[model samples]
Target: MDITSPSFKENATRAIGDKSLQKALGNVERGFIYKRAKAVAAVPAFETLRDAARDIKNHTLAHLDLYLEAYADKVAATGGHVHFAETAADARDIVLDICRRVEAKTVTKGKSMITEEIALNDHLEKNGITTVETDLGEYIIQLRGEHPSHIIAPAVHLNKEQIEADFRRVHDKLPPERNLDEPVALLGEARAVLRERFLAADVGITGANFLVAETGTSIIVTNEGNGDLTQILPRVHIVVASIEKVVPTLEDASAILRVLARSATGQEMSVYTTLSTGAKRSGDPDGPDEYHVVLLDNGRSAMLGTPFEDMLRCIRCGACMNHCPVYQVVGGHAYGWVYPGPMGSVLTPTLIGVDKAGHLPNASTFCGRCESVCPMRIPLPKMMRHWRENAFARHLTPPSERSGLGVWKFLARRPALYALATGIAVRAMALLKPKGGRFRTLPFASGWTRHRDLPAPEGRTFQAMWKDRKAGK
Candidate 1:
């Protein structure tokens, strides 16, 4: 889609005011948070698994070049083509070229964020190749002409009612009197429609959750069986993935997979964890005849030796986003990019530049919930802080925010002055407090008081309270 990260503030304002969106956002907390907590609680070694996952990713990243070479060699040995794409444009061109060589008229796709990152669908459509999204959520959003709001749950921002409306509008060929009030009905309708597309497709495209270097396997984990059909029922199967997605071995991938589903959808294991090595074997009953992998760098290799390199460890499990308060409130659309939440805050800035996506890093409250729950233990808040510093250094941050930080920095350097100023300001605010011990508006903090009242400071600074406690007074 378009880079809307620049308009994040405007998008967040509109999202907060949208009642329908607020209602849909409620599902995020209710559906994901509790389920993840329960799933994690059930696994006694979950924390240990998280550490293993992080170490696996770190090791793979360190030897990424070697692993990638090994992976390409393995794919070649199995009669598969491996194309390395240095840019998003290159990735798209490679896929298009493959499709043209195959004389592909229609393509079916599994849910793939890399495809979204490269804007593959738009490019293919523009080239007269009809592309269809086979995943249910993807199909719904495709009909609505929208990008995924959440990484794993694309239609999480939408409700069943809205989906019913879209289904009715787009599937006008279906019976007008047909029932689609239930989610099952919606699934059945989508399945029926996508089944046709699957059979008719000349090529099927998928995103890899992990690419195994040892076996040259491209693996995808999905709750629905759509991924299997999308990859198997077509003449050509194309895998599009970022370079960082490659793991050194299948064992490393399995270890990482241990935490992926729990952190993502709270399942012990996803219903379908399919591994494709290459094209169909001689005795294979059903498989693609042609297999290809397009490995897109897209600025990832640039992050390798940088502070943001830790972000590459992301499994796309989305635990960070699920627990991010900012994302929970505003939803993914507010971030205005292909990715959203804490991971997006750091990654978006690197891929698109802090100049365009500066607001995303500043969007966090720095509560650190994202880091706490991340399967790979990515320090999301720290990465966001890095982006913030990058933005400020590049003069991309707004002047008002820069001045505010400048004022804070001056006071921060002098402890006594900072304490005295905070003490005086706290007492003054306490004296000015209304009957309910809250301020409906503040002189320089109108943004804070706009949506909710600010509580009075209780006539003392945190330092004073701590001093008193230390003295046992």
Candidate 2:
């Protein structure tokens, strides 16, 4: 919740040293990558679905203002209240005021990154309302008094033993002898604990996966059904979501849904895809007495026409982050924000300002995996380069990096100079007599050599070879 993006290098350094976090992050590769690969491979039309999803979101964004008004009108017509917040402060105030109006003592929440972005839990708790995160992953981090490390899998940075300890520490009264040795036992216990909170909650809050303008519906997709309970069990239901979540129609939403789960968790569809249009009508079986939709802009509106606008098309499926090599090592927490990974590298700078989040974009290797795997097909590497250019132009980049780039730029612009310099450098590298023909340490490449040896240069420069071939020498 705190803006620690400025200290990302330090945070990443710390994360790298944490053995437990290293073990936990192994799941990112072992579980998510393999499952997503298999799932995508099985669907011959998955790429077509991604293209369709991207187009739907693009059309929606192009006419976003119109769609937003239509969505609001539909929500109001369905007896749901819509509140637009231009800033994070406005969103937090709007939610707190809603809690106060409901006379709420306790609020149960589904997993909503928008709420995290707005720091809603801290605001509600400070205002005398007890906010409980009913999502299993969120609940674990809440109990640990920490923010979610990953967006889709909030507690993925944690291991089973760590979770077992948290449960033991928090559920002390639930019998110390209870077996939590397996994932099922742990889940059953959390379900039981959260069920009581859900029943007692005065207000239920959730994030929307998609808001359908045609139907005036807010949709949530979940594997555990906690989102269903969080939004329906209380007298008041509050939907806190970013404005970009709006889709033109149920059909459009369905298209996006086709890719969301496959991209996110490798499932064809999540277990629960609940859609709510409004408040309870007369003779309705059971539903919330009040339904409020809080649409938070939070700098997203400013991004509409910029190079970064493509980022708005993001589904938050986390496929970008899941495939990112940088994120694979540092994990989400190192990004030092609610959002993390390649998507976070782009969006965090837009939301929080590039000056503070400059390090995130620089963290990438530009392998292009993030863009290749993204369901939205956002040009992540290009956007990251855009951020770097902005940082350099603003003189916000570190002087050392800027100077290094300046030297490289000068050399790169002149073909003859570049050829000459590269040839000399290649020969010099060979002279280093790199043990086993690899450098254990290098002057300006300590960062890389520290982790692994730098192989010595091989063969003559291509320029010399080209000249020889041309002359038939």
Candidate 1, residue 15: how far the Cα is off, in Å: 0.9
* TM-score, predicted candidate 2 vs. hidden true structure: 0.97
The TM-score values for the models, in the order shown, are: 0.96, 0.97
The model with the greatest lDDT is 1
Cα lDDT for residue 158, candidate 2: 97
Deviating ranges (above 4 Å) for candidate 2: 466-473
Error of 1 at 351 (Å): 0.8
Compose the digit string of candidate 2's lDDT tens values, residues 1-473. Answer: 67889999889889889999999999898678888888999999989999999999999999999999999999999999999999999999999999998799999999999999999999999989999999999999999999988889999999999999999999988989889999999999998998899999999999999999998999999998999998878999999999999999999999999888988888889999999999999998888999999999999999999999999998888888889888888889999898999999999999888989999899999999999989888999999999999988999997788889999999999989999899999888777765698889889878778889877887468788899999999
